[model samples]
Target: MDLKEQYEKLLRYCYMLTKDVNLAEDIVQETYLRFWQSHTYKDTNKELAYLYTIARNLCMDEFRKPKLDDIEDYCELSGESEYEPEARIDSLVIEEALEQIPKDLRELIVLRFTNEMSVTDIAKIVGISRFAVHRRLKEGLMLLRRNIGGEAND
Candidate 1:
């Protein structure tokens, strides 16, 4: 797969980590820059995993800094009439539900579902075992389903 194709997925992963779109975009750009600069891309077969690892590390480093406040800016979707109503509504619901989950679970869920990454790849990116990834994915999906379902019942 083309590294460029991973841009949106990587951005989503970073956004999940930082909860800030601008910061996530910066992390994604820095990830690609560092990935190219390190030249590890030439040796590593898991390009996506490597990029994700870089972005995750950057997000961790950002968290270590003392920031005044975390501005929560969800719903970055544009209010355009071009998008289908159902799709837009579903997107918002899913985004809202995802925000309610634990950060660890949320990141795993995004990597697995949004990025369409395998359990092994996710484990490598997350530095956890495949078994742990599976367990967390199951738990996260259950929570996500409950959250989405609760919204429907409301």
Candidate 2:
């Protein structure tokens, strides 16, 4: 697949994880930059996974930083109507629900759905077994459904 074709996927992957378009764009650009800067950049087959890994690590680093309460006063992002209200609402709901999940589970859901990556590829990226990937994906989506007002299985 063309690397350019993966741009939107990468953007969505980062955005869902960060919930910030500007940060997502930066992460996508940095993902490409890091790939080019590496000495082991010859492998074409692993490029997609490598790009994801870079983006994921960048988001992780951002999450590790201590957040300031005052930062919110100046950090609101503005945008126009790019998506339909219903679609946007659904995304907003899902994102909010994702925030309630544990970080690890949220990562699994983003990688599986936003990135459209297979369990095997996710396993490789996350350094876990394929079985663990499947288990986590299932558990993560279940949590999302419940959080998003789906019929609770209780």
Candidate 3:
């Protein structure tokens, strides 16, 4: 894989971490910088996974800072109404519900759905077992569904 492919994969992973396009781009850029400096591109196949790990760590570090209010303000200023009103409302509700989830579960949902990573890959990235990834994905989805006022059959 070339740099462009690496970047695209990294961008998707970063977007999963941040859920904001601009922030995702920024994280991808930072991932490239660290990757280049670390000289971890000898094997192109590993590049995507390596970049994801870097981006994930960076996003976790960012989350560690006490900036919940800042994130809320940013989300508000982005204007939820700019999109279709009904969809926007639903999105806001879902996002708010996601915020209530613990970071571990939320990360699982983002990795599974937003990044479209396989359970094996997510387990490798997160240093967990494949079974654990599946459990987390199932539980996270159920939590999200419940929080968003959707019925959970199981």
Report the C-alpha displacement of residue 27, candidate 3, in angstroms.
Answer: 2.0
By TM-score, the best candidate is 1
Ten-residue segment with the worst summed lDDT in candidate 1? 72-81
Write one digit per residue (lDDT tens) for candidate 1, span 1-154. Answer: 6556778778878877776667778999998888888776654345667778988999999988886553332233322224333447778999899989998999999999888998888999999999999999999999999999999999
- Candidate 2 vs candidate 3, TM-score winner: 2
TM-score of 3: 0.64
- Residue 52 Cα positional deviation in candidate 3, in Å, after optimal superposition: 0.9
CA lDDT of each prediction against the hidden true structure: 0.81, 0.75, 0.73
Per-residue lDDT of candidate 2, residues 100-146 (tens digit): 98988998888888777878778877889999988988998888878
Better candidate number, 1 or 2, judged by lDDT: 1
Q: Is candidate 1 or candidate 3 better by TM-score?
A: 1
How do all models score by TM-score? Answer: 0.83, 0.74, 0.64
Query: Distance (Å) between predicted and true CA of 110, model 1?
Result: 0.5
Which pairs of residues collide in model 1?
none
